[model samples]
Target: MPRTDAGVELAGVSVRYGSAKQPVTVLDSVDLRVGAGEFVVLVGPSGCGKTTLLRVIAGFARPDSGSALVGGAAPRPGRGAGVVFQQPRLFPWRTVGGNLGFALARHGVPRSQRPGRIAELLERVGLPGMAGRRTWELSGGQQQRVALARALAAEPGLLLMDEPFSALDALTRERLQEEVRSLAGRLGTTVVFVTHSVEEAVLLGSRVLVMAAGPGRVVEDLPVPLPRDPGTGVPELRASPEFARLRGHLTEALRPA
Candidate 1:
């Protein structure tokens, strides 16, 4: 999928929950802009509304005040963006190909084209020939790969992920992080990723937004200085002095004041 000029915008966006007598603000007057094909990560403590902000962009949640837009229009769910959740959320009864085919169908892909499309999606996610396997038959990492493949089945311009690799083991998490970063760059997909790990944020994000709780807001927005070359492997990058310095900087910014 070649890159498209799909971007995200939020202006004075606010979200609240709870009773009328005592509403709790999950997001407070948040403003953000994500350009086409950029990778942005949201990092914050538990109550900072990172997921809520994502939902607003995904068109799954509406803001109580202000506005949110994707591709220069009010966001509509399942339109121009694909989302990968923290869980694989695959159907146990569906084969890997079947799962991706479902997404293609929802995206209005021709029925006859689905097989080729599913195969391509699986191959892109590093699961080339396992589409026939049931979702339950795969390991956790494999399942997550299928989830990612499903998300990409639509060839969406915008990809939204909420800590999609957090459940995997360390080795698996790192491997997936590398794959996702490379894939997004290669496809030129705009991405908004949410995570609590500062390392993960630094590794995957071109720009990182640090949020704070108690009426969630962005406290810091920092652009990553690392190279995005696919040839620069994650291990090599992580070992660099620049990477270490940036990680320390973000760590300090995340500290409670």
Candidate 2:
């Protein structure tokens, strides 16, 4: 379970696009609260505004109404949380170390100290001694590993991920899911992850929130009591009866009412 703290809180949040007279509502009056160190997953059908909600929390999208707060304050554009998108979006021209150094620089970390920190971050993400490799030289999963390292360079208390593993193949996605859940648990980093897969949502989240389509609103908030095993116990966890039951329950919940 997650402890109540100054984590993420949304109040009456809503978003709309197009002309006011004929606007399309993407998110309706929605409210949510996530505790510190909690891994919160956003699951929904396509066009259900999962990414839009993530953007709001990231301070990238201003809501049409209501407010979003991180750490009990309005999100500071680049200060509150580190964001990871679907694509690695690394600087193609930069080496892995260079990319991480750029992030450290933005955070005002001393130039001489970046190498050790970059190395440490790479090691944390399971990519060691590859910092000098060009971003283009790494595989898709490797590039994303670097991207995760870069995001953690700031050591943010909150991590907002937008379908980060969606582009990876099955095995890669599963591996990353296990890695991220373990990382979040070990670092006590609060995460709000968006995904379309029920199994993914259940596997990574301490709390799974399901949203309804057509002006997206949360319809279910389910807690996962499974143990956190990093990557070691993932296969067994997924095969458990509890996991299967929860997965089936969420699948049914996704059906139109």
Candidate 3:
């Protein structure tokens, strides 16, 4: 039974596209449940349908069979789940504040409070006083930070991210990963993040689910076996023995089965 306390749940969930006669299954019989405040990372090789699983939970894709639910029921689009894509996806015409304000407004935040909320969100994402900056003026990493802030501005119970930091440079990617991990912990935000990097998964996830290819199904779901170092701790985390072990296991799991 899916737990009532689970923030996100999927039971025997599968998805397919195209005509029925020649249907292609992207996700296959995936069973998962994430409790509130848990950061769950989904990692797999290319074409493993990692992003598709996220889409299902984000209410953007219907499963061909079984169920996907957020907060104990089917998620409603733009409601229970906040989604962040591979690209920043911020409107070029909108200022950083405008982008976040749009999400807050859509979520019924008062117009009078939007400015303070936008500032708070920008500060949360490490972009203090940056609301006036246009999207184009920010770096790739900065734009992605804005995207993250916009998603959080909705105050969704769950956040679904599809490789949001993949396009960034290695250093920037590391910075944002730590930022997200710490911020999620601070805000008690439940996150489902997709990534190809084993180190990233180990570093960010409370539990990491490794999926298989073809009709994607989870091959391994392992709890990250390290104490979270909340302050300036990722470097120490990456150097730890548990990190090495999990990274090795995940790397092996991603190989052809």
Candidate 4:
């Protein structure tokens, strides 16, 4: 089992939209905690405030109430939290190397150390070379890998990802999922990921949290038994009786009696 010692915690968090004229509650008193080196997945129907919760953790949006803490401290915006979204959001004009180099430069890395650090990150994410290639030239999966490498370059204490693999094809998505899981373990970073797929949640999450639709709250929080190793073969796990048991449990929890 993976260590659950480090991670981000959310307490009584809620997000509301509209004034007295029209109030829309997106999240309601949701509380969640992701352990260190653990990968936790958020899964629900569309418009379930999944992305909103991720944003709150990333410090991109403030919750209407409660607090989001990274490693027990109030989250500091754009500081130690690294985020990767559905879109790669790379700079079209900059080469792959440039994109990473820019991130390293922002952290005030000296020029002498930039090359080695950039190469290290690239290798870490399985990108290897192709540093000088244009971002647009890479496939969707490759681009996302670069984006992830860029995120890791910051040496963030926590990583927040919002439906990052949802945009790719099945094979690419599965491959990236395996790669991301491995990278997170090796890097020892806590990851709070949001997705709509139950299989994905089971495959990648150390713990899976199911959210209710209207006012998104954690309706179910269950730990996944499957190991994170790629050789574990998530598809086979899905076909197992245990997988069916847990999947049905999550489905029932999400729907209620």
* C-alpha TM-score for every candidate: 0.98, 0.96, 0.96, 0.92
Clashes of 4: 2
123-235 per-residue lDDT for model 4 (tens digits): 98888887889998999999999999888877886888988988899999988988888777776778888887877887778899988888888987898887666567657
Model 2: ten consecutive residues of lowest lDDT: 1-10
Instruction: State how far residue 214 of model 3 sits from its true place (Å).
Output: 1.5
Q: After superposition on all CA atoms, how large is the RMSD of candidate 2? A: 2.3
Question: lDDT of model 3 at residue 38?
Answer: 93
- Which residue pairs in model 3 clash with each other? none
Q: Candidate 1 vs candidate 4: which has greater TM-score? A: 1
User: Could you give candidate 3's per-residue lDDT for residues 1-257 as a string of tens digits?
Assistant: 11224398899999998897999999989999999889999998899899889888888888989998888789778877778999988889989999999899898999999999999888889999999999998999999999998888877768889999989999999899889988887778788999988889999999999898988999888998687657648889888888899999888888775
RMSD list, candidates in order = 0.8, 2.3, 2.7, 2.6
lDDT of each residue in 1-257, candidate 1, tens digit only: 74486799999999999999999999999999999999999999998999999999999999999999998999989888989999999999889888988888888999999888888888899999887999888999999999998888878899999999999999999999999999999999999999999999999999999999998999889999899979999999899998898899999998888
Candidate 1 similarity to native, TM-score: 0.98
Between 1 and 3, whose lDDT is larger? 1
- Residue 186, model 4, lDDT: 72
Best TM-score among the predictions, by candidate number:
1
Q: Which runs in model 3 stand beyond 4 Å of their true positions? A: 1-6
lDDT of 2 by residue, 1-257 (tens): 12234399999999999997999999999999998988999998899999999989988999999999998888877786888999999999998999999999998999999999999999999999998999999989888888888888988889889999888999888888888888888888899999989999889889999999999999989999887755447889888999999999899999878
